[model samples]
Target chain A: MLRINNLHVKIEGKQILNGLDLTVNAGEVHAIMGPNGSGKSTLSHVLAGREGYEVTDGQVLFNAENLLQLSPEQRAHKGVFLAMQYPVELPGVNNMTFIRESINAIRRARGQDEFNTLEFLQLIREKAAQLQLDEKLLKRNVNAGFSGGEKKRNEVLQMAMLEPQLAILDETDSGLDIDALRVIAQGVNSLRSAERSIILVTHYQRLLEYIQPDFVHVLVNGRIVRSGDKQLALTLEQKGYNWIIEEDAA
Target chain B: MKSPVQNAQLQTPQQRQQLQREWFQQLVVGAEVDAEYDPDWLLPLREKALQSISTLPLLNRKQEAWRYNRVDNIFQNSFDPLFDNDLEQKICIEDIGLPAIDSYRLVFINGRIDLSLSELSELPAGVILTGTAEALRTIPDQLMSSFDHLHQPGEQLFTALNTALFNDGVYLHVNQSVTLDRPVEIIYLNNNLTRSEQHVGSMIQTRNIIDLESGASATVIEHFISNNKHEKYFHNNFTDINLADDSRLRHYRIQDESRLAYHLSNVQITQHRRSRYFSTCLAFGGLWSKSAVRVEFQAQQAECDLLGLYTVGDQQLTDFHLDVQHRVPSCRSSEQFKGILYGRGRAVFDGRILVDRQAQHSDAALTNDNLLLVRDAEVNTKPQLEIYADDVKCSHGTTVGRLDPEQLFYMRSRGIAEHSARKMLCQGFATDIIESFELQQLRDYASEKIAHTLNSVESEMEHKNGH
Candidate 1:
């Protein structure tokens, strides 16, 4: 469902992602693990089509379409979703209104009928119940004063509503407590299907315990130095990224 | 009344002044002291007003209050003072298009009370609702004592101009302890019928006085509208409100004038002990408009809330100047004003809150927020707080910014179009102030008008961009 070929990206003349490559097929979950400054978040931003990043070389293809050619909103409409590391706080936009607009927008782009208010309310209630989210939070401004855990849950709620073909969770577990992590993992697990793919990007190996990945890639200095099965995640959790760097140097 | 035309020949400053003097002389010619209907006491007040306005020079940009506005250019076009005594022209209340509320409706055409168009039979006992001229004859003592106290003539150029030339206006007197069930509506309709051959602009000046006796409560809505969009006119309006002890007044003023018109209004309010005053102003139209509000708390525990929203586009200019004074202790005042400027439009907001030396425990807050859609649009906001008391809580904040780029991107990323995202943010910015209105109908009306303005401006800009 997603492919990155020698992705070389730079911000303000400082290269962040250099010669990085990854591939994920439908019905597969991949965990990209790295230490600080390993370009984990940079790869997510490039896939999400955020501006200010210079793509000096190579390309990203999503479902056989050249993702770099599309705008941010165009990428979104084409079934590409990015659960931001830090979800923005919109002061005046209501939570329910924002989510409804997002769902309807994507649906409209795909030539689908929009959901009425009643239909949306029912869908949101069911999804929110699955995630154990407070229904009252839907009436407040979008993450304006939400707690850290609530913000993460809200992002998961959005993912459930959007139902994108490829979902990139960037640091989704960075600020979550253990309970929140389990609930988020549960939400992600519920969306697993034969035609959907998810890319989990994090520094810790704890999230891999809740929703195990089919592939684990160790990234360092903007390059994937190791690719293995789920056992690699357990190995890195015991020894950290130093051994991986040593092995790459050898 | 014959329309006065401007001389086509080039004139010097002395010649212009001479023309102005001649026009003033013609206005008061036969009506100098005892203009047939003038009461014996009102004659001297009019004479004093005329004497004051005759010498008070037109405001130049040099003055602090008029610095940001082009006051001199508004007077360049010669205007004849409109005095329409044609009481025979019948007007249907349904045609006015206002919400049909069960209240006393006082309608004025060209600054004179339209007796045939007004309905006042349902007024409650002890509640006086009539034209100012009639109030002067029937409630002479009440009018005499409060008129001078509420309105200070010659304090400003337009106030004196309206005082010396105004023909008639609405007078609302709520007697002591009287609580009105329904709001009183005062509609000022400018219907300029001057022929093209005359080629003169009409000037409409009027005053509305509302006095709430001790413990009385009422709501008043002042609506100013124009029938002809192409008519060129100058409307100078003055509203004086006095809230006595324990009384409350919710006052709303809506200014929707012609696009070619100039509107200048002054609202002066005085609050006594334990009195409360709430004012909401929505300014949507006019080529050049300014509304100056001055409020004073004369006794302890008085409270006031001032909320305003103004939208201007396509070379329009709107200005708001609010001055609130806390004279006694334990008083509170809050002011929130928001503006949205599109095209090459410009706006100015000057809000000042003063706490007297003896006004301990005075709490005051003032905020002015403006949004400029296009690069050429400009706004000048100044929030000033002058507190002489040591134990007072006063804060003022002003913000001038374009729509948040991140917010826009967030909305756009959800597959919403860019233009729609901007419209949502703009509406959110303006609706915050419109929702402050206590009347639901007014809130809905103002919201619809703002949305219409935003839609037209957005489409026009998009068209200009050839999108």
Candidate 2:
């Protein structure tokens, strides 16, 4: 469903993602494991078309269309969703209102009828129930005073609502306890289908226990150097990234 | 009147003295004409105000209160005082943007009360609503007790001018232990300059007095509007409110004047023990406008909340100066002022809270926040807190910033366009203050007005870019 070839990215003259390439087919889950400063988050942001990131040399194809030429909003319209590692807090914007506007905007772009208030309320209630988020939280300002667990759950709730074809989960497992991780992983696993794909980026192999992946790739120095099945994550967790880095050097 | 060449012939010191004398003479003539028909008890007050205005000079940029304001630009054009005879055409309240309310309403054309447009019938017992002159003739003792006590002359140059030259205004008095079921709305429509040949550049000075006795409660809304968009006029307004012990008052001032108009208004409030005062101010239209609100705690355990929102664009200038004084023990005051400036619009906010030496256990806080949409738009905010009592707690903060780029990016990433996202953020910023209003109708009206202003400015910017 998505392909990246020799993706070269830089921020302020500093090379971050150097000659990175990855490909994912329909209905397959890919888990990207990397150490600190390995450009895992940078790759997710580059795919989402965030500003201040210069794509020096690369081509990203989503469903046979060039994704780099589209704006961030355009990418969203084309079913590209990035669950940010650190969700931004927007004061004075109601959480439910924002979500409704976003859903309607995407629907309008896709030539579908938008949901009214009643319809939206019903849809959000069901989605929110799946993530175990309170209805009161939706009435409050968007993440203004939310807790860490609540923020992560809200991100998962957004993912469930958007129902994108390609979802990039960047460090969604970080800062979450075992219980929260289980709930969030369950939320992600619910979206798994024959026509949808997810790329999970994490520094640990703990999240793969709940949501199994078809492929595991180790990203070192901005490029994926190792690719294997689910057993690869368990091996790396038992050993370490240093062994992989040494092997890559040899 | 002396010619420019003749005035130049005099020495510098003589010219200064001569100008002061001319200003004093003009003020005395206006005051004397107004005092001719006023009650006997008001003549001395008018004379005192005339003497004060004679000695006190017009405010200049040198004063701390006028630091960011160019008062001289407002005074460059000469203005004659509005008289009772200037009321020619009658105005309908509905035509001037006042919503229909099942309550008492008093309409003023220029500075005189338009009796034909007022609805003062079916008032509750012990409630008095009439023109100031009529109140002086009827309830002279009750009206005289609080007329010039809270708002005195010589406190400010404009207050002195208003006291000396104001012809007519509303005088409302609610008796002890009475609670009003509906608000009392006073509409001041500035349509005096339509007779350009006789009253061009005229000044409409008005003074409103509101007295709520002990345990009495009411809501008062003072709305100022203008009909002439191109006529250059001046509106100087003064409001005095006295909340007795255990009483409460909700006050709102809506100022939407002509683009060529100059508006200067002052509200003086004195709250007694255990009383509460809440005020919301919305300022939208005016070339140059200033609203000064001063609240004083007269006894212990009084509380007040002051909230305001002002939106200006296209070379308009708006200023708000709030002074809240905590005099006795256990009094509390809080103020929040927000402004949205677009194009070359300029806004100034100066909020000060004073905890006096005897005001132990006083709690006060002041905050001023501004949003500038364009590079050329300007905002100056100064939040001052003076605490003399060692046991008091006071805080102040000020912020001037644009919209959060991160929030913008987050909204846009949801497929909402950039322009729609910006409008949502800006509206949210302004609505945060407008939501403080207690009345639902007023809140809806204010939100609609703010949205209209934002849409018009956005369209203007788009048109400019298209050209």
Best model per lDDT: 2
Error of 1 at B84 (Å): 3.5
TM-scores, all candidates, are 0.91, 0.93
**Model 2 Cα lDDT, one tens digit per residue, B270-358:** 89999999999999988999888889999999999999999988879999999998889999899988888876988999998888899
Tens digits of lDDT, candidate 1, A1-250: 8989998999999998989999999999999999999999989888987777899998899888999998878888998888878888876677898899889988998999999999999999999999999999998888889998899899999999999898899999988999999999999999988899999999999999998899999899899999998999999999989998998888
| Total clashing pairs for each candidate | 0, 0
Residue A50 miss distance in model 1 (angstroms): 3.0
Off by over 4 Å in 2: B1-36, B84-90, B147-155, B192-200, B461-467
Tell me how far the alpha carbon of residue B13 in candidate 2 is from the true structure, in angstroms, after superposition: 13
Per-candidate iRMS values, in order, are 1.7, 1.0
Model 2, span A1-250: residue lDDT tens:
8999999999998999989999999999999999999999999988888888999998999999999999888998999888888888887778998899898999999999999999999999999998888889999888889888888899888889999999999999889989999999999999999999999999999999999999999999989999999999999999989999999989
